[model samples]
Structures are given as structure tokens and as C-alpha cells.
Target: MADRSFLQWPFFEDRHRELAKTLDAWCADHLSVDHADIDAACRKLVSDLGAAGWLQPTAGEVLDVRTLCLIRETLARHDGLADFSFAMQGLGTGAISLFGTPAQQDEWLPLTRAGKAISAFALTEPQSGSDVANSTMTATLDGDDYVLNGEKTWISNGGIADVYTLFARTGEGPGAKGLSAFVVPASLPGFEVVERLQVIAPHPLATLRFNDVRVPKSALLGAPGQGFKVAMATLDVFRTTVAAAALGFARRALDEALARVNERQVQGAPLFELQMVQGHIADMAMDVDAAALLVYRAAWTKDSGAARVSREAAMAKLYSTDQAQQVIDKAVQLHGGDGVKHGQKVEELYRDIRALRIYEGASDVQRVVIARQTMGAFLGGN
Candidate 1:
């Protein structure tokens, strides 16, 4: 079993511990199924998670970051796709939860929490990745509605979501300040799924196009010019959860490596008896623990009433994800040829962990965020 000792840390409360236990049991019981049909599997997984009431944390008032982190970590330890499904539910609806009007929340949150609806976050465009300020999607005001005309690629749940919390340029200024957020339903007049994206480890991803799709002014999330702030706040909450997911992957890799070394015999002795193998195990253990510390520290900071946690969250994501790649690599190395073989857990993990480093904010982008935040703090006192 993966380590449960992390729950004992002061960073967590009794409710957090209970949530972790419940989710671990739920995932073990419900997540065992063939994932060859990635789309079908994702749909079913989201429905099952919703039916079980696990998606409640993704919506509603009072989002507890600690609970979110614990859920992602527990789910990730069992299934990466399960983790993805759960994370997307929260991420896709985060804007609504944080800034939606009463009617908007009522219209969507219940169905979303019940798994009857899928949600997506439409932010990245064809021309923009991490550069949110450069987004070119336009939402032109026309009386009581805004007509959207642009394409969003690299969108999670792009082809299948029921509604998208979309960001578009609304002319507050030249950069991020000009951006605005809207909740656009998939059934809108001119919205289209341009392409279904395939990656190393598949989940539902796609490119979406909006052609004169009109949404009522009621669909606006927060004030017109507050979209950038809304997006940043949403990211700050979810970024630490990404680190927790990485910690889960690293822990599972360590467990696999440990089991392999004990079972495999070499030179008339077990592989665990070798000094070099022992060193690898030690390094894996340290990396897992260190990653856990940073992940929870960031989560705890957020839960303890920080308006934003860019520096803490960035460090957690950057270190935990980068270290997880290292830990998984070591696990694959320990397995020798079996590691790279198709259908192997370590092999799947190798693919699953890769995108975590790239998404949310890439590791390189996170370093820059950290450096800027650190310097801002140091220089602000003067």
C-alpha cells in the first residue's frame, strides 16, 4: 500500500484524513476497469465519481484546498485517468464556483456535482499557451449579448464538456486586463469541436472553435475586466493539487520499485541485496517525502486563508513534478526491460507523469513565477 503517514502531518485536519481514507477506498472499489477506449473510460469515470458524491468539492461555496489535494493524491495513487477526471471537474468549474452569480451556480453546479454534466476550462488559444496576456479570442459586446469568435486548443474535456468557463478578450486594455470570462454552454449556436487531441497518455482533450456564438451578459463571470484575476485565483487553488498528484505518482513508483527489488534474484541473491539497488531505493524514498512536504505545505497555506499562493504553489508544482519524473525514471530503470514494456504500471506512470510537468504551468514557467514572486517580496519591503 502507499504511505498513509502523510495524513498525520499537522498540515491536515481530521476531516482531511477522513476524506483521504474514503477516497482511497472508493477508488480501489470503483476504478478497476479497462481504459483502452479512452473517451468511454473517462465518461464513465466522471459519472462514477459524481454518483459517489466525490465531485462536491469541485463546486459550491467554501472550497477546501486540503481536501482537494488529498483527493487528487489518493485518486492518482490508484489511477491517473481517475485523477484527471476529478481534477477537470474542479478546474473546469472553478470560475463559476469562485465568481459565478447565484443563478449561474444553481444552473450548473448541481448537475456538475452529480456527474450529469461535464465541464471544461477554455483558456489556452492557438496563439497562447502560458502567455495568458496574449490571448486573441474576442468577445464583442452586442446589446445584451457577447458574440465569441476564436478557437481554443489544448482544452481539457474539449469535445465532451456540457459547459465551458471560457476566457476571451473583452477590451478592458491591451493585455490580461482586457480579458473577460464567460460560461458558454456546449449547445451554443456556433461552437464546434474542431479536433480531438491524442497524447502519450490519452484522456479527453480537443480544440474548440467559436464562430459568432452569442452568450447573454448573465454568462459573464465576475466583472468584465476581472477575468485575469479570476483565472489566476482559480489556478492558484488548483496548482498545489497538481503537486499532490505528482506525489501520488512518485509514491506508487517507489512502491513498485521496492517490490521488484525484493522479488528479483541476481547473482545468486536478491536484487535488494545490492548496494547500488539500495541507493536507488533510498533516493526514491527521499524524493517522495520531500515532494509530499512541499505539496502539503502549499495546500495547507492555501487552506489557512491565503488570498493567493503563487510562490508556494509554484515551488510545490515545480519541485514535486520535476522530482516525480526522476523517481519514475528510477523505477523504470530498476525494472530493466520490463519497465518499457507496454501495459506495465511503471510504463503507464512514465507517460502519465510527463504531462503533469507540462500542464498547469510548465516546470520552467513555474521557476520564473517563483523567482518573480520572491524578488517582488524581497524588494517590496524597501
Candidate 2:
């Protein structure tokens, strides 16, 4: 069983514990594959996860950050594809959960929870990664519809998703005030997957183009000029979960390394018997524990009625993701040349963890967020 010690932290409740236990069992039963076909693997995982009722936590009435974190961490420990399938469901429907009308929720949430519809979030553009307010995609209102025109690149589940939570510039005002969020169905005319992106991990990432795509005004997520807020709010909830996913990867790497060192022999003794190897293991354990603290702390703070968790989430995402990269790298190093061998679990983990640091919010952007929040708390009327 996955460790339940972290769930004992004051950050969690019985529901969180229940979620962890349920998801742990589900993952053990479902995630028994090294499927090389990324898209097919993700599809099967999503359907299985949804049919197993593990996805209800993502689509729950209350936005339980703790449940989300626990589920992602557990799924990630078992299968990154499983984690991605669950996360994109939440992210793709987060606006609907937070701000969608009952009509919208009834329309999408059930489908998402049932795994009949795959979701994607389209925010990053070719020129706009961390700087979301600088997005150039236009969604001009035309009578009862909004005609979308522009591109969104690096979209998770882009080609495979049945729908997307899209952000576009709907006004001429400067900065984020002019942007709006929309729930654009993939079946709409003029909405097309421009190109499929091949990444190190090989998921269904793509560049999307909306060439005069017209969506009903009802597709608007919140309100016009609130896209930035909605997006940030959604990220605030999801970012810590990203850290949780990283934590899972780190834990798996540690497990892999531990098994290797305990059995792999070297210089008249097992690797674990060597002082240097022992030190490496110690560091790995320390990093994993530290990451768990930050991750759970962020989730707890958010679930405790904090309006926003920018600082805490940034700290968690930044530290956990970066530390996971380090932990996985160390694991690779510990495995000697076998670590670098293609198709090795450690090698795949090394590649998987690298993108976590760069996406959601890059580590550099997270640092800026942390420093600014620190300064604001210290300087704003204090």
C-alpha cells in the first residue's frame, strides 16, 4: 500500500483518508502496464479511472484540494499517464465547477466524470507561456456568438480532448482586463488541431487554431474580462496538485533506486552497504519528505478557506518539482549506466519530471511569484 503517513498530517480529514485508500487500491488494480502508445494508454486509463469512480473526487461538489492532491500523488506514483488523465479532467472542467452555470455543469461534469468526454486547457500560446495576459488570441463577440481567431500551443490533451477551457482576448483594453475564458467544444466548426507536438514524454500535446470559430455566448466560462482571474484561480487550485504529481514521481524514483541499491552488488558488497550510496539514499528520503510537507501544506491552506494560495502553491510547485528533478537525476546516477538506457523506468522518470518544472508555471516564474507575495505581505500596510 502507498504510505498513508502523510494523510495523518493535520491538513487532511477522513474524506481525504478515504480518498487515498480508495485511489491507492484502484491504482494498484488498474495501473499495471507500461503501454507504449501514449494516447491509447491515456484513453484507457481515463475510462478505467472514471468507471472505477476515482474521478468523482475531481468532479466533486466541493473543490477538495486535498482529495485532488492525494489522488494525483497516488496515481502519479503508479502511472504518470493515469495522473495526467485525472488532472486534465479537473483542469479542463475547473471553470465549469467554479463558475459554470448549472446548465453547463450538468452538460459537462457528468460526461467528464464518466470519462465519455476528455478535456483540455488551452492557455499557452507560442509567444505567451508564463505571461498569460499577453495572449493574442481574439474572441470577438458576434451577435449571440463569440468568433474565436488565433492559436494555442503546447495544449495538454489537445488533439484527443473532447472539449477545451480556452482563454482569449475579448476586448481591446490593456493587460488581463480584456481577456475572457470560454468552454469551447471540439466539435465546433473552424476549431481545429493545427499540429500535434511530439514531446519527451509523448502525450497528446498539440497546437490548436481557431479560424473564425464561433461559439455561443453561453460557452463563456465566467464573464468577459474575467479570463485572467478564472485562469489564475484555476491554477491556484491545480498547481499544488502538480507538485503532488511531482512528489509521486520522486517517490517512485526513490523506490526504484532503493530496490536497485538493496540488491545490486558492487565492490564486495551491496550498493546499499556503501557509505556513499547510503548518503545518497538519505538525501533522497529527505527530499521526498520535504516535498510532501510543502505539497500538503499548500493543499491544506487552500482547503482551509484561503481566497487564494498563490504563495503557498508557488512554493510547493517550485520546491517539489525542482526537488523531484534532482531526486530522479540522483536515482538515474545511482543506477550507473543502466539508468541512461532507453526504456528504463528511471530514464523515463527523468524525462517526465523535467517538464513539470517548466510547465504550469516555470520555476523562474514561481520564484517571482513567491518573492512578490513575500514583499506584498511584508510591505502592504504592515
Number of the top-ranking candidate, with lDDT as the measure:
1
TM-score of each: 0.99, 0.97
Q: Give a tens-digit lDDT track for model 1, residues 1-382.
A: 7888989999988988998888888887898857989878888988999999999999888888888988898888899999999999999998899999999999999999999899999999888899999999999999999999999999998888999999999998889899999999999999999999999988899999999999999999999988899999999999999999999899999999999999999998999999999999999999999999999999889888998899999999999999999999999999999999999999999999999998889999999999999999999988
lDDT of 1: 0.93
Task: State the displacement of the C-alpha of residue 372, model 1, in Å, after optimal TM-score superposition.
Answer: 0.8
lDDT of 2 by residue, 1-382 (tens): 3456877888888878887887787777868755688888888888888888877867655798988998899888988888889999999898789978788899999999988899999999999899998999999999999999999999999999998999999994788999999988999889888899998877889999999999999999887899999999999999999999999999999999999998898887899999998999999999999999999999999989999999999999999999999999999999999999997999989988888999899999999999999999999967
Off by over 4 Å in 2: 1-3
Predicted candidate 1, C-alpha RMSD: 0.8
**Candidate 1 wrongly placed segments (more than 4 Å):** none
Of candidate 1, the 10-residue stretch with the lowest lDDT total is 25-34
